[model samples]
Target: MKLKKPIASLVSVVLLSIGMATLVTSPASAHTNAVSATCSALSVDLQLYAASREGSPAEGYTEYQWTRTVVDNAAWTEYVRYTYTPKKHGKADPADASSTPLTDPSHWNADNKTYDNSAVDTYIHSGNGEGSWFWWIATTHEAKTHLETKWSKNEPAGDGWVKTGDSRFHETSPAVEAKTNHVAVTIDGTKVENTDFSTTFTKNYPFSDKYTSHTYSVVVTAWDDPMGTHGWTFTKSGSSIACTPPVVQVTAVFPEPVAPTCTTDGALPSLPTDQTGITFSWDENNSLKMVANADKGYVLTGATFNIYEKPGTATGDCYVPLEPVTVAPQTCQVGDGGVADFSGGSITLPTIAGVTYTVKTSGGEPVTITDGKATGLAPGDYTVTALPAEGKILTAGETGWKVGEDGSATITVTVGASADCSVVQPDSKVTSTEWADGTWACDATTVKQTREVTTTPYIWVDGAWVLDTAKAATVTEKQTRDLLASERTVCTEVLAAPPNTVVTIVPPTCTADGSATLANGVGYTWDKTSFGPGLWTATATVADGYAFDNGSTYQVTFLVSPKLTGGACSVSQVLAAPPNSGTFSQVLAAAPNASTAAVLAATGATPLPLAIVAMVLIGAGVVLQPRVRRAIFTRH
Candidate 1:
């Protein structure tokens, strides 16, 4: 049973510990509560601390109890009347007892005996109002068997009296015995004050002040001193606490953006429009300018300038004297048609005072020029003619001009290279002695030939050689020469002529024309005139692209005779001539009568066949007979 008691205590402790685990609750956050108490004169203060005042409702109930011992000494005495009746004597009268009070135990009598003498007794009773007890009232008396005497109080008799003697006088003592008392005082089952009170304890409570307020309960118990055996008394106190949260402030931060960049070498830069810190404008110099306030807490620093195009000056000149002017030249065989090769030739005119230039072909009309442009020229040799200003003479030899002493010049275009003698050769000259017969000899002439000569006659009046208006003249000397003997003989005597110089004349036929031909292919035209009957002379003219041999004409003579059968013939004849050196004369026979000639002239009459009695003569008196021959004739 003793072992069971210990085991039961262990089981109870384990059960209590396990139950406490389930009863435990989570606390707000991980923070613990702080509490403290202080004792002072007649006052006690309690304090609680925590992360915040808001948490599980706090429990701070306290009890103050006290215990003490005290001594109590109270005393009292009472008197009672007793009547004694003897057994043998009939009812004796009760009386008050004095000596040997019922309270005196040793004086008490018993054994169913009666008091022989009734006496009055005094009794004492003592109590602290906690309990009461009575003892038998005793007296020294002998009981009578038949007559009993009972002591009775004036009031009612209580128990604890053994009825030992029907009535006995009970007396109370005057002093009561002293007693020691144990006293205890308590509040809410706690001990304090007179019991030497001192204690320390800590307890945790859950609380939270995340939003609303929560207060901590902290109780303080105190007591006043118990004067002498008086139990201690106490009063309870607690601290007033309200949890409050501190105010919190929050700040926001943002990320900064990268600054925009610009270029100097490319086209116009596009500025950022969304940027708040940058501004753009044109300065007074018309240059692009940018400003940045850096309102976003950034630093702006760099070098900048305006870009533009600058105005510049350039110098140049146009010389009027070097202005282009053209005067084309032509190349040709002398006296033939040709064109100038102006493909590579041009000129620059000058503005010299009193100097003017004219252009024209040799032996052609002058061409007009206005402002360095000239009228077009035909295919021919040309000259750029000019005259020097007054008081300025032509520069000799360098101007390629035929300049005169009068200061005029011509730009003469040479037909060939400057050194070619064929283009610059001088005219030939011949001197011949005359025969004593008053005729020039053929092989006896002395020839004097002039050497070729070239001259630059152009005047450089305007940076170029130009023809002068006044040009040097080429002088020609006329010399007359008589024909040579061969020429004269050939001219007078037809057989003496050179074969190339021979002339053949055909005799005229009554029905056909006559012709003349020269063997040298030197074509000629003819001229004829009449010198009376049967006498006619004709002359020859050489054609173009041909020349007479040393300027002489040859001649041939021939004749024709006809016979007539009737006196005064009525027949008529006409003759046709071929191409010859000169024109031929028309021959007509006198009509047989004036009326017949009139009729012939009037009707343009046809001719009748008849014998002719006429004479035909050529050159100088040469004659021959006529014959009837058939031939064709044409007038030319």
Candidate 2:
């Protein structure tokens, strides 16, 4: 018979028992009591074994036996009682049941149900009519059980589960290894041991096989397990792999600055031959090296420095030679000290000589050759000299020439003033001779003189001879007294004459007291002091021999004046007096009577008035006398 153990609680056992079994001989004698009924029948094998072997017919039967060997009585006090309930009914006939041996404990506990086998070691009991009775067993042996608990299942309803008391029969679990780089594994069943495997094992195992294939989940949590303490979880799959960090590269870029070029024109500077260096500065900020080339030369826009030739070095071409004069004159004497003479005897000076020269006069005026003219000579001397044009000097064979035996002389021929002879005569006596008495004699003769005047001559005064007049007649002394006496007698006679007398006396023509008298008349003197003419009182004197007429009833006349009249007279003639005197009454008493006067006057009368008076008498007689006669006859 096959006996099955409950996979949840009971274990199965297998054992070998030796026993004698008799064969029943057919037709043989009667059997003795010792000849027991040899029951070589199959029995149920029962011992403590893993319940996983129950009901595995292919694994065959298992014999199990138990001995009460007390190793630890204290641990054995609480026994573990295992009971099995079979699902099938037990058969009454043992010959009809089948048996098989169980081999592996892994197959015995695999199923959750129990199986039945016809075995004497197992008791059967029924639970009313609910199910069939299988087996029940109680043992007092040391429990070989282990318990494993995860901290996640310490409290079943909360996050944990616990196995204690009757739950000690649970299966043991394998140990779980703890690791640093992977998920921690924990055993949950009894008889478990913690293993410290490598983290590589945790990575290889990933998760329990109940989860997805090729992809697994691990309990990565903070918990107290038999393995370790900490919390972590790693979920992995077939395609998951670790990634490497990326690589990077960095680079730097820089910019370059540009330099400037020189473009200055016409900037040649004067430098010393020994100059050491030249540094050029730019308007902008830059630094550059100067490279000299045959075509481009040196750049000067930016800064460029140069080291030059030394101070005393000679360079470049020499200066040009001085230009030559175009037209130079020949060598000639110049200035005032040098003398130039005419080569020939009749040389003339040039009209436009440019230089100065000394012109010496040999036998003529001292002439100076200046402004092309010979000056400073008198009129007579310069009349033979000539002059050149302005600004020229006398040269040899030019303006003038030298005569024979003369040295360097120029002849200036010019007009001169005339000679003056009026200065030769001075103010001296000039006489004229007349031939009187047939001899050469000088008498005073009147000669008219004139003046001779000139700007160049001395002054001349009048110096001619003059003549004198001859003297007149002289009177005698005896004749002069006779004439004076006759004049006195005539004056006395004239004084004695009376009023109304006419007396006439001739003047005495004689001399008195050395005075001359007249010869042609008498001398008479009168002083009619208080009376009219011909009535005189005698205060008259006359020359001797002159008579006085007094009371004679005659006219008196005296002569004391000159006889000359009505003409120019000389100084001696105008001063002479007449010698005659006459009475005024006698001249008045000699008048003729009227009728006799008319006859004598008729001989000397004017006929113009007589003729006019005769014409008026004739007209009046003819016009008025006849008118009067006619008027009278009418009246009668």
Candidate 3:
């Protein structure tokens, strides 16, 4: 008969009994008080582990030791000592339970339960229950009584398996061995303490056979409440990880942790690459600083930045500083340089704060002062120079200054300007022209602004603001009328040779100063006096600042046709009477365009041209002929 004890699944238990068991046969005829019995075999196994085992991890690891024998004392005595290393996260597995047996104590002693089979069974099972179930555990007196009462009843060894007490195959010891591991829990890298952790587990015990295992259950829980939302999971292994193990190990494995997430805000847009964490410093009154912290194993990444007049944060009035800040420093001012205030007072610059200027001493290094103001300046002579912007000049401060005993002194520079000048233009009286009402009839005359006053010349440069040396003149200046071209009036015919006609000529004129302006001088010359024949035109030209009053004119007409006459004429006396004298100096001129032949014909000279008639008259009268032939046929 055998009792059972739970087996620790984390450890592999194996028990080997090496000592020989003595076989005692019931003597053919037992003495009235003698007894003897024979046994078959004996063994024990132990496999145990703590809550934290291989493939299992918690706060830390735990250690265990086994100091017991795995051999029977009534049979052979032998034992092994072993120790289990603490679980190192997932690396938690103890060596197998193996021991060398030796015949050390072969006697039975139930009084002490030591140096016996009970010790061996206890060592193998981590407890006496399961191991003892498979061991020969009866007391010395019970063993003798059991052999006499059941197997020694005159039964021989050859008798077909007679009842030997209640037939038994195994027995067990009383000692129980157990182990425990520390319960630990953690999240990320932080430990979880002060919390009870547990897990439900079953410990199987040994069978009725000497070498089998027994089982029971022990519940343990491991948990970590770090940042409750850290999100963690727990699982058991070595049993049903993916498949069930023939011998359960009850291993608890915790997978690698997922880094916890921490959302950050108010970080700088542009962070340096090397520095993943941020630290800031500034005065809240004027400026702000922002920084960012990268997650573990990462560095700050760089980013672009955009400047703005104000932060466009949605938290309206809520302002949180990401870093410390500092404010700008204050400064004092003395004066500025510009156009000297020539207002009779001290010609000096004005005061302005925080403006920079460079002060250069003759031989010393240059020093910069703000607002042209300096306090506790090294005593010496120095020339203050203005570092004005480009395109600007030091208009107000250009002289070197001596540094007086006064520790506080000022210098300034100025900018901006302009100048003015005046000159007089000579004024001349503008003449009012009395122009006759013009008639536009083909032959009628038309008049215009025929003459203009000339501008006066002055000793001055072009574009210069000249100062007038004398008063401007106000007088009627006569215009110089120069004849530039001439034209004549055409007469058709006035006898053969006509008298010259005197015309009223009006010359085109301009001011004398026009020569300064016009490359071509101005004026028009036309023949208002000389009147004659065929064709004519009035031409005009101009100097600078002047133009012609009128353009060139078209052709005029001239004719030599004559007219008939019957009344008395100027040359009638000479014609009626022949010239009695030696000579007649003149002949009568004909009216313009009249036919002289027709006129003489009307005088009854002849029906021929005047030249032929004159020839006939001279012949008749000089030779004192009786009559002129051309007149002979007339009705005188």
RMSD of each: 60.4, 68.6, 47.4
lDDT of 2 at 133: 35
- Give the best candidate by TM-score: 3
Q: Rank the candidates by TM-score, best first.
A: 3, 1, 2
User: Each candidate's lDDT (Cα)?
Assistant: 0.34, 0.25, 0.26
- Per-residue alpha-carbon lDDT of model 3 for 237-258, expressed as tens digits? 1111111113322211112212
Show where candidate 1 strays beyond 4 Å.
1-351, 414-636
User: Candidate 2 residues 1-636, lDDT tens each?
Assistant: 133444322332211111111222311122111101112211111122111211211322222222222232344532222333343565222211221112222211222233333342343445554443333223355656443433221234432233432322222443344322223333222212223222122222221222222221223221222142211222221212222222332221111222221211222223222312222232233223222211122222322233322223233222211111111112222222222211112112334222223334445434455554444333233323333333223334433444323222334443233332122343233333331121111221222223322222222234212221122222222111111222222112233332212122222112210111111112223343211112222222333433334222233332222122233423221112222222211111111122323322433322111100001122211211110000111100
TM-score of 1: 0.13
Q: What is the lDDT of residue 564 in candidate 2?
A: 27
Clashes of 1: 50
Error in Å for residue 562 of model 2: 45
Which candidate model has the greater TM-score, 2 or 3?
Answer: 3
